[model samples]
Target: MTSPSQEEDDVEEWRVLYQETFGYRRPLFHPEHAVFQFQPDPKFPGHQRNNNRERREENDVDEEEDVEEWNPWKESYEQLSRGVHVMNSFEQFVGAADIQCFDHIDEALKFLDENPEGHHEKLIFLHEGTHNVNHTIRIASDVQIIGASSSEDIAASVILTGRHATILEIQEGARSPYLGWITVKYEVDTEHEAEMALIMEVDAPPPPEPNSSGAVADNDDDDDLEKVNEIESDQTTNCAMVVTGRGVEPIIESCHFQSGNADHHTVVVKDHAAPKIKNSKFIGGSGGGIIITHQAAGYYDTCEFAQNLRSGIRVQFQANPYFYKCAVHHQGEVGVFILDDGLGHFQNCDIFSNAKFGVELTSPNANPTITECEIHHGELGGICVHEEATGQFLKNRVHNNAFLAVWICGGANPILRQNEIFDGKHGGILVHRYGKGLIEDNEIYGNVLAGIFVETGAQPWIRNNHIHSGKQAGVYFYDNGSGILEGNEINGNTLTGVQIRTGANPRILKNRIWNNDNGVLIHEGGQGCLEENTVFDNTTTNVFIQTEATPTVRKNKIFGSRETGILITDGGKGTIEDNEIFDNGQAGVMILSEATPIIQLNRVHGNRSAGIEVSSKGECVVRENRVFRNRFGGIMIASGSNVADSSLNQVYDNLDRVSKAIDRGHCLFSVSGKEFYPMHNFYRCITCNSSDRNGICQSCIKVCHKGHTVMFLRCDRFYCDCGADHLERSCCLRQS
Candidate 1:
């Protein structure tokens, strides 16, 4: 049994022996490999390369472990196994079907130009060495130019260095010509005569043949010539490769492209040309790595771009390209930039470590879709869609960014859905500067700032997202930000679940907000509609409204608070109506500090303290509410505070009926405050009341039952029936 390292040494020795015999480095192979066209040399006689070697059992080792080490010429081995004849050198070659060999590339091209009738598919192999040309080589037929490199580095071994305006041009009418395993480098100063290293354009076709009348017919050939001249004489420079001409499609694989100067891009595809580029690398370019514009499109797979001066890839001018599994990193600017009506789709790509945003889209006409990509470690944000751009970002994992993971600003209206955005230094998503977005179904957490932040007059519709475990608020609206927040689950934040301040007015509806310091905090003149929400189990209060905040809290279920269900303080004023407030550690509704709210139609019960407590100069209109089943007294009003018009309130079934005892057996409207105490008279309408708890105060008697039959009562059990359904007419006191 041979050691693995010894076997590798033996293979290398055999390769060297074959190289000496064939005048070219040969690939060592096992019997199971592809068939190779190995020509016999007179000096080798009857000795066969494979037959002379000791064979090994296939089951002795795993195929992957026994595989050869990766080398630049490995692809050539596969090609050879496919029955491609390997030439010893460019000058000495045997022929195969549609396969041609030439000592110089120019000669081979000249032959194709001379005899262009028969061969639609041709394979031309270039020897592994530098091929210098003064003029551009144009291909107008379906041909494949493959490099036969035997060196450790394919690109370095099969180099194409040129100082011409263009190195290789695939003209119009060419059908998917392939260029593989080669390096194309521009050598001239970019500021000079060189316009591009490679250009594909439509050239003038052969003039129409003479007809029977012995005259050439007029056609669009002249127009074609003019277009060609325009492209050749264009003043714009510094693009290493250009793919132009409508409907032109080419294949470029396993190639390395380098620019001439700091202002040269590696490739530019425009004018609707579509190319298929695979397993290539664009590195250290002064300009962008690739530019797709002018309605051009391309499919790039398993490519790499790094250290570019501009964006790794830029798409504009209605171009729509697809990038699959590409690695774009270490860029001087954004990893990918789409603007100027650009549209692209990126999937399964790793974009990170860029100087700016990993992916950026701008302009009103820019719309792209990015999916299933891992975008991280950006110097700035992971993705930015601004300047009125629109895009769809779905199912991406964007994390560890220096700023917000995704920023939608400047009137942009992108859709961000089903993405996992977390662990950023800033917020997960930001909509600012009048931006608008539809952000939904995303899992955003572990950010230093808010999970989703809308500020500076931006309005974004946020829904159905799981935002939790953040250092700051789950959702923040500031500086006049306004939007609709619905169907989101926000919890476990270090700060408030929803923080609305600084004049922000957001409609929060149908959301479950819990397990935060404060479930909802509306302060600093903030105002909005908080409706149809479930706010519970907060560390502090379920809802805190303070500092002149005036929000409409309606149709919500607020319960299970660590403290009060709803805390209104510091001049807070709002309409808290139609809510189910219960099971709080403290008062169901606590009001203080001159805060005035309209507390109406709420079912306040099951609290450790009073169902509704107003103190410290607080004033409110407590009307048409059912206050019951509380541990403390119902509707407790302190000395300096008052319920301005306590009408139609059924305050009953409390552990302590102290508020009813303090009412002095008078109607709630009359005993709620000092101002209303003068009207202490109580009455009962025989037609409306069937029990001692059904009665009316003097204010309600004079205003609500003006024409109904009534009877005087001592108010032994004081309650109001004016707002209930027992009356023939609506109560005037309750209406007011």
Candidate 2:
């Protein structure tokens, strides 16, 4: 009845004494060499015993306590024993053959060559710690290769160190080959760069044939010849990942791929191969992380691509890749580059910190849908849809990029909605080179330039966005760019809130434009419709129209401006109608520099200067405006060739009804005794007492009518006698 520790010490002393007497040490038993045996526990007869004997001693000491206590090590051991027994039963059920174990690449290849077709549906284990498989290893159909846990357990997994080559390839007709827990590393020379570390080549489907002609050939063999040609064309062709006549999809899971060569790709799936990769990591590749091209498709889940020299994932030539919960970051180029008619759908992905654009969709007809993604902090831009590429960017946080957050160019149309694009070096969104799309409900602000810039004939519908706090205009449309800007809050910009210049004609409607240099500036011949926009509290004019730009300004609440509410200058002409232009520092509507704007039906009041001012060389049609309550004249018509067709306007309640400044002897009208009279005579008395009165001189008012009640009169022509309205009786002479 010895204690376990005391017995262990006695046995160790005896073993050392025996070893010293024999002049040798006992051989150590390795875990791999020792057979795993299971024995039933006494306390729980059905359950297997744990390898640790002290647990059995403890159970014997307190049986009741042991029955209730939970031992994690015992539980794990029992579970592993049951798993091994179940596996043995399953082996019997499937008539499992012996699993082939290889210590070297040549041994594995030799075994595969010996049992080429016979080893179908069998399992192979690689035991090599690390094998530099310089040549490509083609996996057969229904064969699965499982690597050891670590490089020490099996020599390390396959490493493709060859130049201009791939390590492992599933050739044509190799259906459903499973590759698990494999590591592929590349160290190719730069002179002979490799294409891909691992490539899966499959046969592409044949193209659809055209319809046959109705005309029957004289030879009956013509039909047979055509059938033969069709069969020949339908035959499988050789390409990368050639999966010809295969039913099961090739899968590579739990694998790590790395490369350093400039032209090497971590993995390439081409020629219609559809591979599913899960829980894979691609790191430090000089080429790209993964490339699916030539109509090849892939489904990647829970994958990470980091620090690649090229794009993290590149799909081209009609290749379609769907990624879920993937992180593609710190790449040299774009995180995801879809081009050449390639289509990709990425969901719940993080694509950021790339050298170029985070996600770039280029080439004609290439469309990618990126939803619920955070694309930010790239060197160039966030997302680029160019060269006729069309895509949908929904609920993406694209910000803090070098240039534009979302750049659409070269006739591309991308729908950007619910994206927060801000804190960038340049604009938030740039649509140029005929790019057109719907930019709706996005927070585009905090950029160096405009929040949304449309140039070079690009026409994008920008609506319901908060485009504010920008260095330049909130929405700038130049170089013939035009779009529908509706329901946007464009404010707090350093320059104009919405600037349409250089012949751009953007329809601006219902936008809150405030706290900018100019609320809406239409200059350089830009033409558009500014309607129902609340443009106020601007540092300069609320709505500035200059340089021959003509925009129809209607129904806009333009007030609280530092300058004129609506300044039309420099030959600008448009219909200014029904706008509440008031509370400005200068004239509410200033028409200057030969500008002829049709100002009609506007409530121009509460201004510091004239309600509507027409300066020298300015000729405008000002009519039907309620111009009142201004600090200066209601309507100021300057001298020196300024002409304003001011009519039917309620120009009253101002400092002056009309302030007409006259210089020199070019008399416009004669004002005398609180009335404006037309001057048609210089020397004759236009106002006389009798009808047959002689031509009284200008001195008659002072000499003849001395101490008499003399009334002032407005005469139409220079006549000798005055009318009865001005005189007490009719004149003696008949005045014509």
Reference-based TM-score of each model: 0.74, 0.68
- The numbered model that scores best in lDDT is 1
Candidate 1 residue-wise lDDT, 443-522, digit = tens = 99999999999999999999999999999899999999999999999999999999999899999999999999999999
Query: Could you tell me which 10 consecutive residues in candidate 2 have the lowest summed lDDT?
Result: 80-89
Task: For candidate 2, write residues 221-283 as lDDT tens digits.
Answer: 442122332332111111112232223366666667776656546777777777777777887
Query: lDDT of each model, Cα atoms only?
Result: 0.77, 0.67
- Which candidate has the top score in TM-score? 1
